[model samples]
Target: MAAFGQRKAQRLARADASRKGGLDERAAPVVQLLNGRARFCTTSSCSGRLVLAQGSAADANSWEVQKKNCTWLMVTHETCTKDDVMTALEKATGDVVLKFEPFVLHVLCQELQDAQLLAVRSTHCLEVPLSHKGKLMVSEEYIEFLIHVANRKMEENTRRIDRFYKCLEVALKTAISANNSPSQETENRSVYIHRRKRKTIQEQDVHTSLKDHNEELEPEDDTESNLAIFAEIMI
Candidate 1:
């Protein structure tokens, strides 16, 4: 009876220990990866929190989640801001903000594959299960480099646009001024021509009057000479 009782007691202790182990697993950290969806990194047994900042240090292990020293990402979103990215990462996960450039984004996949070679060459540390994002094979150096390059290209594009708009404004203003000035000049020229035309018509009327007066005086002189001839005959 004593032996049977001891065996049952031992079994109960083992069951208690197993339960404790399960709880410990639950206490472990949890990492969330965003890829058009929010997915937890660990299985049912693991639960905690950690944050990894891209191009910077990892956050506190208040809830311990593993973070890689080398991981690359090519984040593409039109409406997503830097703040939005940080907010998504607030719950102890990596935040890699990759600004998109069509010119660079096209070639980035190949460059990331090359960078993976360097990452594999690094000293072997304990493998922290990475919450894979997409099909882009990338390393930490590649991600950091790409982010900076993309941001620089964005700045250059903004400057180019500003210069283009300034030139357009200047051209439009010049065209408008030319059009308005010519209109005023044309009106002045029309008024001058109208006055000249009026003066020419008045001069032609004056010449006609002088010609008629000379014709009438010639006829009167001929009549006076006829009378003088008649008077001499009488004498």
Candidate 2:
């Protein structure tokens, strides 16, 4: 566990450096592997989707560059609440958790965004029983996967917000169109003059013709657009 902490500290430093645009391709994988969670299954060989950490972001973030790196790592956190982690060992069902390499635990948690929206079903942190084989060595690949999952979730949220805006915007446009009806009023460039109904047959005919002409320029109904308006900007 001492070794895991040391390596995790190293990865955090690396990630912090990377966040600051210090891109070292080789160093990156090492950081992620040593500091990230690898999915595991207790009952079956095939693990579920997510391999989120057992405790906090720090726990989830640190992973082993090689299995040897975290072999000595152990769980020490006493406060494992379900809100941010999974600590079934202590009767705590925290979602965000990290499994020490020695223990295999099953835990249910909500995605970082919404617990209700997504059921992150991956093993919390499977401490590979020395007997349990099959990729006992944590790989940097899982780190990449974690990043992808986070990005996809963020994009989904952005799209949802965009759809909401589009729906609202379309409604607003419809309302405006209804109120200042284009048909009844004339276009500014080609002004429409609303006149009283004339008693004379010729005058009435002219008035009727003008109304018909104005109706033609009423413009297409500002209504539903099938495509989502991704950029809803109100200026």
Off by over 4 Å in 2: 1-140, 175-235
Worst 10 residues of 1 by lDDT: 31-40
- lDDT score of residue 54 within candidate 2: 27
Local lDDT at 68 for model 2: 26
Which candidate has the top score in lDDT? 1
Each candidate structure's count of clashing pairs: 4, 27
What is the per-residue lDDT of model 2 for residues 63-114, given as tens digits with 9 covering 90 to 100?
A: 3323222222222212222322222223322222233221112222212222
The root-mean-square deviation over C-alpha atoms between each candidate and the true structure, in angstroms, is 37.8, 21.7
Report the alpha-carbon TM-score of model 2 versus the true structure. 0.19
**How far in Å is the alpha carbon of 131 misplaced in model 1?**
12
lDDT of 1 by residue, 87-153 (tens): 4434323423332322110001123423332121212111122222321235545544543544554
Q: What is the Cα root-mean-square deviation between model 1 and the actual structure?
A: 37.8
